[model samples]
Target chain A: MAFEDKLSMILTIGILTSSALMLIGIAAILIQGGAAGHSIKSLIAANTTVNTRTLTLQDAFSGLSGITAIYLGIMVLASLPVLTVAALLTRYIGRKDNLFIAISATVLFDMLVAIFLIPYLLH
Target chain B: MLLLLLVAAGVLAGFIGAITGLGGGVVVVPFLALYLGVPIAYATGTSLISTIATSTGSARSYIKERIANMHIGVSLEIGTTLGAITGSLIAAEVYALHLQYIIYILFGLVLFGSSYFSIRKLKMKNFVPGKADWSTKLFRLNGSFIDEATKKKINYHGRRWLLGLAIMFIAGMLSGLLGIGSGVLKVLAMDSAMTLPIKVTTTTSDFMIGVTAATSSGIYWERGFLQPLLIAPVVLGVLVGARLGSKYLVKLNSRVVRYLFIVVLIVLGSQMLLRGLGVF
Candidate 1:
């Protein structure tokens, strides 16, 4: 199969899995009355500020044990693109396409800085 | 009830975005921030997540249909990713300074600008193939895809690659800054600068947005903006709605989509501007 076909398959599966996880999270929240004791009312409240500052990664991961579905879903959604880029870079390397490899590397570096370096610098 | 409302909103956004070939972040941002009273920062972050879902949702068919140009998309990412990093830095500064109103004003301006271009684009006919420039040869910016509607294989090459990259850089910055896919600007860069077909422009823009969003979303996450609860319903709804929307896209007349886009842009643009100016 062509590269595009592989990519499409990966994207389709990634999206389906993430969406399913998100839906399950919603169901759990609704039925359980909220994630980890926070009521659904407060979680979705119009005036709420439930951001990363308030909800740590540790908290989110802990909630992954059937307490909250959304956090894991989001983790999957966010990481899929990074993984796709990595795959593209690997393909370019196999073909020895320096130009594309460089471009892909640049994109990965940018992502890394945005995800890790910048946040660390800000502190 | 709130989850249901979010899902409903996401579905509408995804439907309109996919059908119009505009992408959903534009609609999601304004709807969440303006209509639903979410903070602008949180709204943008949430919309960024939705963009990834919509892109992934429609990507399968786009790839199968072969309307998208991966070479062009990957090459353009060089500019976009760098721009996204810059844009996110700016966003961090703006939020820290509590000058998010400036971003609102910029978003409004961009929306109005894109609407103008969308109308202008409507008057234009199909692409008249142009000569490939030096950059095109260097970058290998050429490909052919079958036009599903015409049932003919359309062969084409791209020119003005550097120009396209420059425009894509700005588009990337806007994507990161606003937490949108910024497909309008990406399409504009390709459609106007690269002289690609509108179909190619839209599909290729769709192809590129996911990586761009991911790059910035990482920053949004680090900045403590990725609110999981808010994102769940929006992501799921948009993925499903966009899938349904893509099925109907080929059947709709271009003129109808253009008109709908103009109307939406006008209303959302003005609302964002008014809210930014403290008039709302």
Candidate 2:
């Protein structure tokens, strides 16, 4: 398949998966009446301390609760762009498009640094 | 009830954004921060995440249509990603210092400035390609797309790669700082500096926004600015609304929509500025 076709497919699948997880998470939160050990009211409160910084990905996955599902969904959504860039990098490498390969690699590298390195450095 | 209201706001922002070609992030931040009284940091985080939804949701069609130039988008991502990282760090500092007023003022200025681009876009027609310089050849910044409106294949090449990249960096910074897609600046960089086609710029901007937002979203996520409960409804609503709006975009008179949204931007921009100045 063409690169564009692959990209479109990746995007479509990513969005569908993420949205489904979010909706299911919401439904679960409503049905279960709470998530991540917090009541619905507290969870949705403006000044609530429950956030990604407080909730680890391990915790988000350890329980099948609504908040965890939503966290997983958000993770999937956030990864889509990185996935797209990685795909682009692979395609460019396959075609031996040196300039484009470099461009794609640089972008992917920057994103990885932001995602992984910056957090550690900040702390 | 709050969840429902948040969803409704997302839908409205997405609808208006789609029709206006502004994207949802522009509308999301102001509404969430100003009207809903969400903190600026969280509002921007939510807006950034919701932006990814709109970007990914619309990317399929844009990519399929081949109006979006992936090569250009990827190239530009180099600048935007770096800018996003810097901007996100700056935002973290600003928020920490309780200097959110600066962000509000900057966002207001960005909104007010975008009106000029929107009005300029209305007057723009029949793009003529400029002389392709060395950077264009080196970067391979040329592509041809079949214009649906004219049914003619339009071949175009970008110039001033450095200038476009510089503008893209600033665009990326604003996106990370303000939690917006910063499509206006991206479009301006491509449309004016790079001299690409409007269709190409708009579509390519859409393609690039997800990666740009994602770049900063990582920082925001690490900072705990991403609230799962707050973001879920907004993302879902924006995806739905943007989908519906895009489907109906061809049928609606875009000029009318643009005029209406320009007014909205002006009002929102002033409101944010006034709020920042403690006048509201």
Candidate 3:
């Protein structure tokens, strides 16, 4: 079978895999009986009041890790198609470096998804 | 309000990561935990995904340039891919055994090793690369690249054999578990053990990174660690940043890049330690 055909198959696999995981996590929350909803506690480790929390003087980051993980997972399967295309581009088109550029393009696209796609999803 | 901030952070981290050859995961993992109120475990998952994505950006370019040795890369990839499956399984075992301290120690060592090489290799850039030995003769680990500054082509040789594969296996295992590019390990495997030159080692390391990412990506996906909510911004940011950085490589200084690379690793490594300790 062609790489493209396999790629689409893998993508389906990725979607099914990720969605199942999310559902499982969400189900864990449901089973926890409102004890573990996707609330601030589910997302963040600490509980700081909005007004009185001490702000650090330096450029300390207000990290976005939970959301970041969600997006990172999303990007992988998303990039698989790009991975397939990159492979094809190198194989039939470039004929020079072959799988290398394909992998690079696939990775680059994964990063881009993180930068551009996450905000809308949160809302 | 927080959503806007995350978008901005994603963009900033991606730009810095692309220019430096640092994994976008290295940038995003901490940023997500500290700024966006993400948990350490989730951040790690996101970071791993971004690392896979960002590495591929360079993988494409390197391959396009024929800078990557595909045969060696793919051959080594088999080891990495299988190692990844085993390592991912081991991640669960390690976590269950509560031997997370071991992982922290390992991360620290890797950081120190990368720093030493980055520091030490600065002055040795001009040496003549030695000839291809038994490995290059047997496995034929050889390549050529156009020197950007000189506009002249530089050829490299990887003349060792048995040792390089061993290094590749070790590198792959570490890479799968840690979510790193393992570029340093790949370089060590190629340059020192296999007798590859510095240039070829870097390019080959670059080439090898994507396979490492792919290896773990499969498991991360299998375990349901990947989520769309996190993957989008980091991947987009990395793609743009990598492109910008690649375009600017000719004008950049290698030493500065190397230094920046070490600094980021140190910061990220510490963050991982802190998170693992449950202090942050």
The Cα error of candidate 1 at residue A66, in Å, is 5.4
> Per-model C-alpha lDDT, please?
0.80, 0.84, 0.54
lDDT of 3 by residue, B164-258 (tens): 77777777677666666566677667666765555455555655665566556545544444443344445555556655654554445555666
What stretches of model 3 exceed 4 Å from their correct place? Answer: A1-123, B1-20, B34-37, B97-105, B195-199, B274-280
Q: Report the lDDT tens digits of candidate 3 across residue range A1-123.
A: 644345335544554454444334333433443211144343323222110012111111244233333333454444553454355445534546544454445444533332334222322
Q: Model 1 over residues B159-260: C-alpha lDDT tens digits?
A: 999899999899989998999888888888888888887667777777788888888876788787677777888887898788888787666555666688
lDDT of 2 by residue, B97-128 (tens): 88989998998889889777777767755587
| TM-score of B-chain for each predicted structure, in order | 0.94, 0.92, 0.83
What DockQ values do the models have?
0.72, 0.80, 0.06
Q: Which number leads on DockQ?
A: 2
State how far residue A61 of model 3 sits from its true place (Å): 35
State the displacement of the C-alpha of residue B159, model 3, in Å, after optimal TM-score superposition: 2.4
Model 2, position A78: C-alpha lDDT score:
88
Order of quality (TM-score): 1, 2, 3
Error of 2 at B44 (Å): 0.4
**Taking the candidates one at a time, how many backbone clashes does each contain?**
0, 0, 50
Number of the top lDDT candidate = 2
Model 2 global lDDT (CA atoms, 0 to 1): 0.84
